[model samples]
Target: MSDVSTPDPRQSRLFTASELLGYLVLAAVIFIVLPSVLDAFRLNLFGKYLSYAFVAIGLVLCWGVGGILSLGQGVFFGLGGYCMAMFLKLEASTPENTSIQSTPGIPDFMDWNQLTELPWWWVPFNSLTFTVVAIVVVPVILAFIIGFAMFTRRVGGVYFAIITQAIAAIATILIIGQQGFTGGVNGITDLRTLMGWDIRPDSAKTALYFVNGVLLFAVLFVAHMILKSKAGRLMIAIRDREDRVRFSGYNVANFKIFVFCAGAAFAAIGGAMFTLQVGFISPTLVGIVPSIYMVIFCAVGGRLSLLGAVYGALLVNWAQTTFSESFPELWLLAMGALFIAVVMAFPLGLAGLYDDYLKRHIDRLLAPVDRMMMRRAARKTSPKAPAPTAQAAE
Candidate 1:
């Protein structure tokens, strides 16, 4: 009989050894390998890429797992980023620093627009505590509102996606129109310090990169837990057959809302981290284009796998940077072609490729070694010919 303690790889559990190993490998890459190989600049760039990994991960849960394809994810990302940027902007806009401006205590953009005082909404962001809370809370609240309004009315699929895209467009327009309050098309730039610490130095940026990695792992852990839970299974059920799940007495709408809000929270955290590492937040990152790019990231990464999502975000952004430098005009076309190829050739993305081809081949290649080890183990545990028999020894 098989050892009861040894878990079958096929068995569903809270955490598998292979899954843990995946996490460790990812951690090593993010925390050790990448940092060792890359210079501070490149590492910072990767950190920015990792920030978007947050959105990709949330997509795994929302779109991949729950079948909720929100095209306005950038809205939450921008909200979180704006919250962090607001706080940093405030800290940088001390009266002494802005002494030349008409409004010595407000942001430079506000001053440029002839604003004599800080707006009431901007006042709360002055407190870092408030800003930190708002980063997650603001996005979640918005997600909850949107989810409730749509899901309750049984609105989903293409219609929900279109609505979300519309929201993203509206958000972009508002931010651009409110030039004085939001820094307009120029965006919130020239960010110098954070809580009195100079964040401009390479060392500080390196430190922030590690912090981003740590936070990403934390989010990954949370996502893993959610995936292993009953709610996660229910989410899959809801995604596959919403009507059947509803008929089974589960409140399908509630699950959808919860997952959507959770996804928004994840995206918001990523955005906040992006603001911290990149030192700026813009409406461009909040528009429909960036939102679609995020979905593509998830799709290319294998939306069903959290780690795949992270890899997807990193690889795609790295490719964008590399190609943009050489063939800037063709990068968009290249990206589009890449996406089509991935969807048509490998619907499951990178993770699926590994499982379907690479993983099986690897296991086959290792089979002989595994058998040899097992034989050796069995021989060692055997009786060894009964020690040549005590009676025959005489």
Candidate 2:
């Protein structure tokens, strides 16, 4: 037998000690440091930004790993937001609260639009259970249909991206045009409570922020697992050479469909959380522009790194907020210039920067820690020294 030992497949699926440390650092920042440093209001704002991290992470899986670019992630995000919004709107639209309106039990926007009775479809959302299910299922189903129709026919590349953008435009138009049903241009707003919990207060908002952070880490774990598995390997292979994967008897379209649906599911969860954090869902969030913004988030973070995508969302949004406040008239121009500069200077993004320069130094610093861990693992796996035989005991 060869002297070299075979690597552990199960161990290979887990993150390395260095990678685990990175995750722990992020968790500390989110759960401990940020909450301690920032007040509730700023923390709430960060919660909103973290919501966008969901979409960015999805883009990493779809566009980065799978090589399936989708510009309509906003559609999935919006759908989730709307689902949650619809449920919240129903909860807030108590007949006693809306006694002033002609329709005493319906949403204010519906009342304004002369909807006498709740729409048939809106009735199901009255149940929170259904709303939660729909948030993930609805977007995934739509993604499945689209992925099936497009991938089966081999429709991809720039063409696939443009089609997704068009879908976003259509979704936005539909939401706005159906004002009575969807809250129209203003979108759903003035959400106050969830399951009888008043979420508008500072204390409540802080709680929600922690919840968002926990959920984000959960997503990161899932994404990391997917990326470390055989499926992840196949995705990378397909991204590099789809024809070769197909020729090898793999169902390329099915893999594409799965990843696309997964991306949509992730975006949808983000949308739902966004509605909870921000108190609204708008047509503006479901349009082509927002979809493009999501892609930019992934690209800026290093499309391949899940943790990088989260940081990208937080940093980019922070800059946008700062610029918009300081230079309201020129913020958009500044953002455009910033993006151009980043792309020109660092083609691979923040993660790429770390890999190229920082990783080696960091690894060197952690070498001792790594060695200790390896020693422990070897001790656990190595055979105990053979017990001295009875005859040899002397």
Top of the candidates by TM-score: 2
Please provide, for model 1 over 150-171, each residue's C-alpha lDDT reduced to its tens digit, 9 standing for 90 to 100: 9999999999999999999999
Against the hidden true structure, what lDDT does model 2 obtain?
Answer: 0.89
Span of ten consecutive residues with least summed lDDT in model 2: 1-10
Residue 61 in candidate 2, Cα distance off native in Å: 0.3
- What lDDT does the true structure give each of the candidates? 0.90, 0.89
Per-prediction RMSD in angstroms? 8.0, 4.9
Model 1, which residues run further than 4 Å from truth? 1-12, 361-394
TM-score of each: 0.90, 0.92
Worst 10-residue lDDT window for candidate 1 reads 1-10
The regions of model 2 sitting more than 4 angstroms off are: 1-11, 371-394
Question: Which residue pairs in model 2 clash with each other?
Answer: none
